[model samples]
Target: MCSTLPTEVQNAPQIDQDSGDTIGVLDCLRLNVYVPNKASSQNPLPVMVWIYGGGFFEGAAGWYDGSYLVKHDVVVVTINYRVGPYGFMCLDIPEVPAFGGDANSITVFGQSAGAGSIDLHLYSPYERLFHKAIVQSGSAKVEGMFINPDYSAAINIAQQLGFNTTDSNEAISFLSTIDSHLVIAASSSLGYWFRPCKEQVFDNVANFVEQDSQNQYSPARIRNTPLFVGTTSDEEYTYDMNEFAGNPFLDKIKTHYSLSDADLTRISNTIRHFYIGDEEISSDLLRELNDFKQDFHFQHPIDRAIVKYIEQGANVYQYIFAYSSDDSPVYHSAELKYLLSPKFDPLDESNKKDLLMSKCATTMWTNFAKYGNPTPESTEEVPVTLDRATVDKRSYLYVDDENGNLLPLTSLPRKYQNWGQDRDWNRGSGVGPDDGVRIDFDNRTVVGIRIDSENG
Candidate 1:
């Protein structure tokens, strides 16, 4: 057994909501392990590791309490990885995936940046690290801004703090001496973020990424790895919708696909016309904006990755979180609250559906970890059998209380890739009402009984 790291507050930075003084302890790499009561030396339980999402610049392990999943008899591990400059700071230090991925039995799962981490791992030299993966709301096929190759942000941050250093050594040295929290705080103040960078191949140093992962995504490269990939119906609804108004997919389209200037203009104009017509914008801009963001960031990339996964003969379980409220629609990271602990557990009779949905989430996740399939065989808890994506069609488990109409992938981005407007929901995207399409029945698509549970 490995000895544990020191107990310290999360290595957080100054963000919009969270202040650095509160939980921003720096360079703390630790793991919180919650083992089941039944887990013994003789009877070892399966393990589930949690990687929190904070756009790669923020987040800590303490945010997610794994005690809820431990009730189901699996060992849960939540780890603290350095964030901001510290997360990607060049040092002779290290860490995967013994639990991140071990035999074919292990399943690596995460949400947003955490999910994006899985994508990085898949594209890196470590693609074979996990046999199966559960990517909730992120993939490597992101915009250029997220993945930078230069150390300009680090230098910019150093200059912003106090030491107006131009040399890389001087910048890193100055930034290193300050409080980890301050470096992060300074980064925020400067509006500069040091994200994952593609490294130049050095002889001895361990490299996380050598080539741009966004450009490296391909079925031939990823090989056959079972995937549990999904996205919420309205992936942008939970955020300030205004953020997406002017920010369109055209920029991502330019970088994602190397197109000529003439071709790029034609595609951009077509996208603008299809999604948001006229420069004044439409009244349904927020609604349409949500759809547009979903398609660009989450929905489109996920489909592209899924197409590759299926092409490589990987068993892929796809889904869309359709549950939402009047206040917040089913958006990015919507399905996470139900999967992990530390969520608002409403005991009132009016919220029975929420409780049942939570149960289904935990069971399906644990099921996926134990068995390669999310629903190897359905039980009272998980009533429906989730089919995997095949070469012919894309099968998905729509996690919603109402509506089962499929959002045909072909309906999106006609000029973007000419992937064909496949409006047919025959095999991969087919789901009759009998296969647990709606929630009016006894939570048919999921599995769980309100077994009392909570976590610190």
Candidate 2:
């Protein structure tokens, strides 16, 4: 594994698919290897396989540089996957061929849409390749799943473009004949949102759907691998493009959703309830739009998955990025520029808080990559434990300007106790997946976190 990595500064390894095929082998698949210098006594360093997300419609590994992790005693690998109709929609069909072959010890990491891919990949037949994972601003819940709401809208748009969505593969084959970028542009112009869909049960290709009767996503259950997951405090803000006086996609959104003002308001409130939590939101169309963004794009899915993982005894840690500034609104993709590059100076130069926060964030992440735990040193005060341990509820490390702080795992929100359990599951009172756990924040210390197994 180490030998295949790029070692010298001037000798970057070429991109290759796991099948030993070159980058060009699959038009949609791409991979890059980052080998750390093995001048030290130990070689064959740990590896991180990154997946980029563009709502599964657009994004490439080349978009995110891995030199950050590579410079810090780890090897980073990134890949390019098919996007839009050419990629996701095409892959769902039975006749479509699978790309990457078997690979091992891979750790999946991605943000946004890429993170969704990680969640889907975990259920894929090829999932065992990665030992663990890190997902940012993405979740494994169907609510978080990136599905195109407007199937008819897509079909109608295709008709306008002189293609047929009812016969999608035929349309795809015709469209594939054209340049990919051109096809994407043409599809978007007519309000056809390209992303992963509910793969049919028979084919089961890319089985990201909730019901996998064959147990495709339940790969014998690797319960030991650690998971680090979280989202920003103001993630919805990025969707608030109009708050910045930028063009609001209200018309475009109307075209896609076709909702009444009252319906839009209800949908907007639902988004606010999930993403912003109990936090107060400013009264504005932008805030409503932000809510819409979080509802369809981010919150519920991640929330559900985290809840399920915690209930299932998987080692899980969670955080909420609360830091924001004029230059950075704690929005989507802000963490990237920090995680991948230290030299990136925010518009208003990064303050001491920013620098300290960046360092703290990166340190915790690297520590996890090296040892699968984020704590800096071993201690009973904050032991690095997983799913079965209540200690984790009180053992979380909050990365902030104050050089970082560790909070008791028990201090997390009480809502977590009941995070992912379905209403039906919660019908009876017990401490398991079947039991619906509810967080009583006012009376309980873990407001939105830490499962209250007793009442739940």
Candidate 3:
């Protein structure tokens, strides 16, 4: 069903130059379209737009190959947006171009920072540009995910480049002159430097913590958009943390949140008790620490988003990619290898399970893109039906080595009890652990329930 293009025809123009327009040139914004052989006006297939993630520092459309999804009778469009300080410096540049053609069936899928980008688009005035979204291993609610509009990091990057200017206009002019590679290198070093922000033009999009505080932000804003969000079993294992040995990591966390020594002790002890369970710090404590980081950064935020979306009467599907290979466990971005890997081999014995998982994932994803629901119908390869998440069952897809199945959200490893409601351990507040009424963590209940009851 797949046809290979001739070598000469395979070569497409690369967007390497900066436009130098009001949009701050560095115009690496382009779309790579993969259309099925049978696609035409008579048989226009659904389109899936991919947004790649590199922590807002680096990402490209060329990194992902959408040929696999194209083979499933869908048009796959991978797009490039300005990363680092260029695309998200809160400059008055032209907004990223919206996808053209069949807006009603467009599904935008992204991973990590790319997923976070999708989250921004969901709340932006241009949210109607797409009909569905799939957010993997990232959320708009994660603290520090979005940069502030003041563009402090941009100024810092400019200073490092010898510009020595804080004026926005002067900085932009100087930044426009620097080589793109040099600017990206300097911004990368600044880590958490350039990212999406709440600016005057689009102030509606706020981080989850801000949304919770204002009571004004609501999933109802994007209620018409169906969402599929999920995370890996070990989202943070991919990062090297050997540098965080001893108390340095704790110190870093305290500084990041502006927590006092006493607050840090309470929060660290709470995390330790939950993940390490009274075990003293040792070599084995690394895994527990990694899990804590994963939950705090990725999973907990996702859980909150899912709950909020469901409460808004939106169709949401959740998943936990627990599939592991002999060589690697389900680390962050591992599922991408199954979903978008160009070298995927289904014939090899070792790849049998991977192939199954990949097929299930691609099918479900493409199915969601084609139809609003993932399990609209079942086929021989995919017999089981995945269910949508609801307030009652909280059903979600559990993708494993065998095949995908609908499982209760509670069955997933790790619990997000008291997530945002716990003012002490949450990312937004600095209350001590002893300040709030004790919660029954064993019951796996959210602390919001108690607050809701008390207010009622």
Best by TM-score: 3
Estimate the lDDT of model 1.
0.59
Candidates 2 and 3, the one with greater lDDT:
3
The candidate, 1 or 2, that scores higher on TM-score is 1
The residue-by-residue lDDT of candidate 2 on 251-308, one tens digit each, is 3323334455654444333323444445454444455556445533445446556555
Which stretches in model 1 have alpha-carbon errors above 4 Å?
A: 1-9, 13-23, 89-104, 126-129, 144-146, 217-221, 238-265, 276-280, 325-328, 342-350, 403-456
Could you tell which candidate, 1 or 2, scores higher by lDDT? Answer: 1
Steric overlap count per candidate: 6, 21, 2
RMSD for each model, in Å, please? Answer: 11.2, 9.7, 7.0
Residue-wise C-alpha lDDT for candidate 3, range 154-194, written one tens digit per residue? 57778888889767677777877888667766765565456
lDDT of each: 0.59, 0.50, 0.62
Query: Candidate 1 residues 1-456, lDDT tens each?
Result: 222222544555535353334246664677777666565556655667777777877676766656556666666777777766667644322322232322335567888888878777777665454556788887765443245555576677788887896777778888778876677767677765656767756677667676665455456655667788887777766346546455354564565655556555555555555555665554456776666556666665666656656766667788777775334578677777677743232222256666677777788888877776777876766677866766555567776665322222311233212221122422112111222211101111221111101200
TM-score of each: 0.77, 0.65, 0.78
Ten consecutive residues with minimal summed lDDT in candidate 1? 447-456
lDDT of 1 at 90: 40
